[model samples]
Target: MSTTTTEVLAFPNIKAIINDNGTAEVVVAGNSRVVPVGETLQDLRDNALALVVAEAKTLQRPVRVRIEDPEGHGELIVHPDGKVESVSYETRPARHRTAAPASTPAAAAVEASDSAAEDVAPADDEAAQQAVAADAPVTRRSLKETSFLVSAPVLEPATQGWRGALTRLGFRMNPSAEELSEREDIRTVSQHWPGPRTIAVVNRKGGANKTPTVVMLSAILARYSGAATVAWDNNESQGTLGWRTEKGAHDRSVLDLIDSSTELLSPSTNAAEIAKFVHHQTADKFDVLRSDENEEGDHEVTAEEVDIAHQVLTRYYRLVIMDSGNTARAANWRRMIDHTNQLVVPVTAIEDRAEAARLTLQTLESRGGHDAELARNAVVIVSESTDAKRSMTGDALKRAKAEAQRIADGFEPFVRSVVRIPYDPALVNGPIRYEALQPATQRAWLAAAAAVAKGF
Candidate 1:
């Protein structure tokens, strides 16, 4: 024979409960519903409580409830198992307020009528409190039809009236990354501002995984330093930073400002105007200077234009990560390298790409023409794949050691540490937002960022 059980739960109002798996269902008052499979009686009760809290939070008010099941107060139960017997709920004080003060006779009459109504409201409030105290096993009876009222306390309009409630919901607040970045912009733009540091995550060979490294490093800097960092799509012909970030094509780009001729030239040339050219890629944190895929004009920016852009950028940013192209080096590349305090050359450990890394090291060593000092500051990174078929030990490592030795032979004392960055796909997609990243992935990115920041 089948069994049927009854339980009563007092909820101030009905709301849909969102389960752990993100599925939602509504539990209504005066209804007898069987708990679904995999959902315990306690689970259902906890869901009801969570739903109540959520509703209270949303309405910004206290909620009222009346029990309709089990025919009695203590007859209601949650965890029927001896492991845990029952659960209880009590209504909190309902918020109330008096009618506003009046000057006119009609208004006065209204206030007087409201004052009389307040006399009866206290009884209702007391009755609600008594209902809250009825958790003990006792007969439950239907009273004169009472309502589960969700009420917002009336407030005086003079002060920052509505703002108080909105503040509780964190209204008009930019996210943490964006808020901190704005402060960085202020500090960077202040008087006595020095030149900003621009580090180009470069590899001349295509498909070298350069873009992902730039994106990850930029995000890491934004999180750790709590500063606004700009990622420039300086890849000449085509770019992917904006596309990958999903910032849309209409986003204002640096190319829109300094294409070929007519550089904004000087620091006095409207800093605000220069700032207007930078698009906040998302809210405010990581800004971007994107690329126009079909920018047809043959107009090419001179070294002077690059210089002006850097000057304006420095005024409003502490760090700029440039994603440069593998094609012919733009005049901006030399100027950028000259201005940057550090140079990051990201390369994979593919046997086929080993010679390309060698040539890049040689190119860095050849800074005698434009600036020798810039070459001295460069850091080489050999990005090892976490899933690389070859081992990090034995002959695979022997080959890696050989590549390191080859670069060391050419650059000698200039080559800094050649750190190995394990391949992380999250770095390729977007910022390591909490919900978007695994705990392990976030830790790996942070560790890599710290390693690089410390000149490893």
Candidate 2:
């Protein structure tokens, strides 16, 4: 007989626990790291949860463990954010029945919400019928599973958002290695970010496509996730980021925000008031904060000023991509690096540009501090700096391509990832429109952006 039980859990880490004996001691682990058997039901749940959360780091994916006991059965669901949802139900004592194979991971879809159910692509009718035919009769225990799964079920790889659906329909038939890698990158980029994250695009070398990276990456993140993102210029003096982007009505720059940061930081300031200093790129759906472009305005940005401005930015944006000046030793530049959670180092096809990027990584490592650790996990982007309308397949082009690849390859051990961007005439000079780039160039930028997002 199937029985119903009720239990509560937050992203529970315990996948499955079997009641071994009447002693009431829950032996939930394989190693010496075991939870002490508790005196009461509440005590048992708390102790088991502590053990599961601690062991969670070793698991590949968050699991929903169906905990079976003599009196009842409980289910624990762990969400991507590591939050646990646990449900307990009562079960009647009966002989055990054979359970279904893993193919029916979605079998517990009864308890899922309408939105979550919609996220699962429809299963093949023929396959569904076959699975049903081969399955045993649903027991009372299965009913409880259904209720808990509907409430909060961890999506398995077989039912992974879009890719799995395509695979099931025979859409993704035969994919090349690059195609597969790019698909994985896209999935990684589109992940749910809980809060604001920062990416600093730097090389300490001008003309390395730093500004373009900041623009392209932030645009991709916002366009795909529908979240607010911003590109910030951390130039100590003057920078052309504002020049290459669409200008707003006001001449507000980073300094304007920094000067008024005291008011901006106040809890009373509304979002509209705080947004006055930011230049919104309407087409790309991301904002830009540039340094003063005036020749006479020679005021240098200090490290403390950058911090104050950053605090204000975090209040309004989900992601921040900073473009640095040519000089790496500036106070603002170092501060930007300090606050950066992910580092993106851009290089070009030119040997000097590529070498300069490599040297920047080396210098970071030489700093012998947290910067060294950050450099080791940086993403390197190699962009072709030419102004060619079509891909140039000349011998010189081939050689440069090979050299750039070689340069990127050398950093495989130290860096998180490296991607090469093809030359696009549209990107050579002028205001960058994300839609204006060639299809190939756009795809390359998407790949680069995905790589940077994954580093976070």
Candidate 3:
């Protein structure tokens, strides 16, 4: 007498296409459904696994799945009992392409297999291999050609808000949605681009918060990304960025940097030598290239000087945030716009400031070419009035909020993004430090910086 081996039957294979926009298109037995999966490659993988496992349990059989994402392609075997076995996984050299949708032949084969599963006998190993070969695309790599190097699942422990409180009290909990969003914002600002980028902060009116916007963006980006960043006062004359930030060892200004641009730009020049002209913020982790502050001097920075200074700064720093003068028509201001990869207009929530910001963008749009493009993609930051007081009556506060909302709404259609910053006493006076900002204000700036980075 001979003993026979029992074969295990599996349901039709499932296909999952993971998209970069935080959603997955899951194909099951020729039917397609789009599911809102969480952001990140790991999220797509886990959610797809759960969906396939649920289908396997419904059929009371194992199921095979093929997953393609921006990262790479992989295959898995899911058992009805919630066990998952990785068959093959390979990561691409670079995350360049998203997975394409399931093809017609593959869908038809999947549908046929699903309909025949109940009536057909359990398939042997050889037959199962043949079925997979017929359903999978010919371009897919064979099992022997793929690697089985599996990455361990990463679980982020809650470290913020109520979820964090539960975690600290000996309970395991996932991060809240708010915390997850904050994490994504942090990730966005922390990324390093391929090359140096320039951002111009302009409003063409005095006291429009251009200086504050430049300082805050530079500080947030530098503090998060840990990259070299410089805030250059691109004013025609006597800009106040130096008065608002920490002082370095020397009293050097942009004039001094321009005088030595040739020496600094020399291939043999050391990177640290250029630091003599920039003032480092002790708390903000960024440098400030101050403008000429001489009370007796009447000299204005010219367009040619702006080019030379920009060249030197770009050579030394990965990011440059330029604070413009009140005159949008000035040669230096026009040149700064020419060099800007991202345009930011910061307006305090006042009628004149908002109007000035609008006019400034209109001026750029009128110039056409790259100026027009920059104006179209500019990020407008609307800040609440610094005069807002906690002691004010409820109606006064209500009017202030309504005005800010109105100003923000005005630019919503014309620009790429409009961010509102709350009134903070820390930003009103003295040297602006990232640590001095309120928690809410800091979060808002982080969001603003992420918006700026997306333009890069």
- For every model shown, the clashing-pair count is 2, 19, 0
Per-model TM values vs. the true structure:
0.46, 0.64, 0.73
Model 2 Cα shift for residue 382 (angstroms): 0.7
RMSD of each: 19.9, 16.8, 12.9
Candidate number that wins on lDDT, 2 or 3: 3
Global CA lDDT computed for model 2: 0.73
Q: Each candidate: what lDDT?
A: 0.52, 0.73, 0.85
lDDT string for model 3 (1-456, tens) is 211112334346489888665667779978986544555778777777767766776676677778898778887777765687767789978743334444655565555555555455676545754675576655553587434453334548899988899999999886755676688899999999998999999997898898889999999999999989999999898898999999989999999999998899999999999779999988888999999988886999999999999999999999999998999879999999889999999999999999999999999999899999999999999998876565666899888878999999999999999999988988888888888899999999999999999999
Best candidate, lDDT: 3
Q: Model 1 reaches what TM-score against the true structure?
A: 0.46
Off by over 4 Å in 2: 1-183, 387-393
Using lDDT as the yardstick, the better of models 1 and 2 is 2
| Candidate 1 worst ten-residue window by lDDT | 75-84
Query: What lDDT, from 0 to 1, does candidate 3 have?
Result: 0.85
Task: Flag clash pairs in model 3.
Answer: none
lDDT of 2 at 411: 69
Per residue, candidate 2 scores C-alpha lDDT tens digits across 1-456 of 222233222333344443443122223343333344545665555555655543443343445555655556867654333467655566857754333434554434322222343454566544554454455344344353232222222223333446557768866533333454566667777876888898999987788889988889988888887778888988888887898898887998998888898898888988888568888899998899988777786798999998998998998888888999988889999999888899999888677887888889888889978899889989998886574325666886877678767777876777888888887777778999999999888888888888888766
By summed lDDT, which 10 consecutive residues of candidate 3 come out lowest?
Answer: 1-10
Give the per-residue lDDT of model 1 (tens digit) for 76-179.
22221112233343433443643333664444554554555556676585554444434323433356433344222222222133544555566642223223
Off by over 4 Å in 3: 1-46, 49-155, 388-391
Clashing pairs in 1: 12-64, 74-137
